[model samples]
Target: MSKMRPSKKELLEGMTPSTVHANEIANVASGELGLEQNDSLTEEEKMRLVCSRFLDIKEDDLMDGDYFFTELDSGKYDEA
Candidate 1:
């Protein structure tokens, strides 16, 4: 007999950052943005939210190629 597979909700609930760095980044991003930890959101999404918050830009404004580190390194969001 075949075993039953987990549902999407179950999978999402069990999901976690694949690496230590990813987890750290997600935690920092969420804390900085005053957001609660959301398991449904990917690491990229969390970082995008951080970038959007700091840059005063919409999350939709960031493209796939855009990264929070790149934006932070660019210093565009630094207060004058």
Candidate 2:
């Protein structure tokens, strides 16, 4: 599919805060900027590392809550 481009009108539309947040999520997912890592990784490996780093960052901010995706599970997502 072609990329979704938000127009000036779309950006300046009189949307509620929730709608704006949802739009932001859509923009991020379409050109997402969540996580990244160094070189020497294949495309698949980079994806795994990116997801792992995102989880780690979330855990850092939310230390009071239990992070259920850690390596304690020891499954495919073992690095988290």
Candidate 3:
């Protein structure tokens, strides 16, 4: 029997960056942004919220690749 898929809410609620490495945080945020195609409104919203929190930026300003690389190269994470 196939294992049941977790609900979108469950998947989104489970994402967190609290235990990630400093140098790799931005990459994690970038990867989360790529998961935005979940198709469920709740899932997409949760993904954005978690990604924004992970990046330490406002959700309105989250821009995926360019922003993640910029923040990484600018030593922004170093300040945290």
Candidate 4:
């Protein structure tokens, strides 16, 4: 018996706002930003660190819910 992976739609539908934000933060922290994983930090803390480093914003602003993340145009989609 083999395990099956979830479909794209299923995966997308299953993600909550926090899950999506965590995934984005992890990717940028590890990949583009080349940040190391800190075991001492919680997911929310890691998110704040990543956003602060990437966007050059203060952690206080993030904690106060003053900033939000958005997907940018990566040229993967055509303008209709």
On TM-score, the candidate that comes out on top is 1
Top lDDT model: 3
Model 4 Cα lDDT, one tens digit per residue, 2-72? 33757968868867886687656456534433433355577899899787887766666653332222222
TM-score per candidate? 0.24, 0.22, 0.21, 0.24
lDDT of 3 by residue, 1-80 (tens): 23476796875574567753547644567557665544345757878877887776577876789878998999988955
Q: What lDDT tens digits, residue by residue, belong to model 2 across residues 1-80?
A: 23465897887689777556765556665223333223445779879977887764654465433455554454856555
Candidate 2 similarity to native, TM-score: 0.22
**lDDT for model 3, on a 0 to 1 scale?**
0.68
Per-model RMSD to reference:
14.1, 12.9, 15.0, 17.5
- Rank list by TM-score: 1, 4, 2, 3
Ranking by lDDT: 3, 1, 2, 4
> Of the candidates numbered 2 and 4, which has the greater lDDT value?
2
**Residue 55, candidate 4: C-alpha displacement in angstroms:** 1.9
**On residues 1-80, what C-alpha lDDT tens digit does candidate 1 reach at each position?**
33476796864674556623555545665455554335457889989977787876677887665577688779978999
Q: Measured by TM-score, how close is model 3 to the native structure?
A: 0.21
Q: How close is candidate 4 to the true structure, as a TM-score?
A: 0.24
**Candidate 4 local lDDT, residue 37:** 30
Model 1 regions more than 4 Å off: 1-37, 57-80
Which window of 10 residues has the lowest lDDT sum in candidate 2? Answer: 30-39
Residue 79 displacement (Å), model 4: 32
